[model samples]
Target: MSSTNRASSDDEFIVVREILSRLGDKWSVRVIHEAAGEPIRFTDLKRKIERSTPISSRVLTRTLKQLERDGLVTRRVYPVVPPRVEYRLTELGQQFLHHAQEIMGWTMEHQTAFETARREFEAQTTEQ
Candidate 1:
């Protein structure tokens, strides 16, 4: 790890946690993945993400803004009928997808073990 990443403190750890927490939301990941291929209008994105999480307009706005501020997404506004707004991934966001895919692969590979562990854990708790 780099010196900066190696520096240890509760606050620094919090920063790392914050970064992941923002992307860890179901809506955020779904939004990013859905919009990855091309720029998606606000309503289109709202529909796609809401299909999975029922995200409120207010919350979606906040999530998109957070992603934009984090340099993961770019929002563009167009002048037209009622105006048009679209969002797409930035290079860093595109790169992050690779890590996400790796996580997916790991989950798939260990799914059986994960289920077994969960069952064992629940059984042990019940026995207590």
Candidate 2:
């Protein structure tokens, strides 16, 4: 293959890997899932996410910023006595969520198989 084509392929691979790294992050997925539907205040999002997994305020803030930078989430500040900031998913984010949900469904369907595979691997390793 041509060097130019190889360079382009390498660049595309890097971009895709970066995107996957961002979306595959635990905090990023949690934030995206919680931020779906209506716009939610930062505090509320934190509270909801914490119910499932504990996360620090700083980490949440950083994750939201990253998601915003990736164009997956939008942050809006409301003028008030105490400033309020809310987050909502963009159209692209919704599309991503749809795909994620499908993958999640597949995982659930094969959860038992996954568990069995893990058990078999562990048993074999222990016998070594």
Candidate 3:
């Protein structure tokens, strides 16, 4: 078996690497952003994102836990029928949103390039 790795100076790469390692996670940023508007029940969060397409429950739970562990999200549990859990963004999480929004804004500015690449990728796959 073969392995690949990336190497760079700690001072040169740590910050960007750390940011990507967290935000680059599949549902981390999305789940956090979804919780930004208000505190949302666990089920509500799952449903909201799944409206576009279903995400595995395991993945959603895992992402929420990571966000919470990183001090970027807050989770509240209620005692009642069937139990209730709510999630909201911590101040740090809101700060993270600023970075996310900047990336999104850049994507919007170059959306044409994204579309072109997607079409090219699709064309290459179909040809094979």
Could you say which candidate leads in TM-score?
A: 2
Best by lDDT: 2
Model 3 TM-score, 2 decimals: 0.72
Candidate 3 per-residue C-alpha lDDT over 24-48 given as tens digits, one digit per residue, 9 for 90 to 100:
7778878877889789998899999
lDDT of each: 0.83, 0.90, 0.85
Selected candidate, larger TM-score, 1 vs 2: 2
- Ten contiguous residues with the weakest lDDT in model 1: 2-11
Error of 2 at 43 (Å): 0.7
Ordered list by TM-score, greatest first: 2, 1, 3
TM-score of each: 0.79, 0.87, 0.72
* True-structure lDDT of candidate 2: 0.90
lDDT (10s digit) by residue, model 2, range 17-122: 8768865788887788889999999999999999978999999999999889888999999998699999999998888787878888899999999999999999
Which regions in candidate 3 have their CA more than 4 angstroms from the true location?
Answer: 1-16, 113-128
Model 2 regions more than 4 Å off:
126-128
RMSD of every candidate to native, in Å, equals: 3.5, 1.8, 6.1
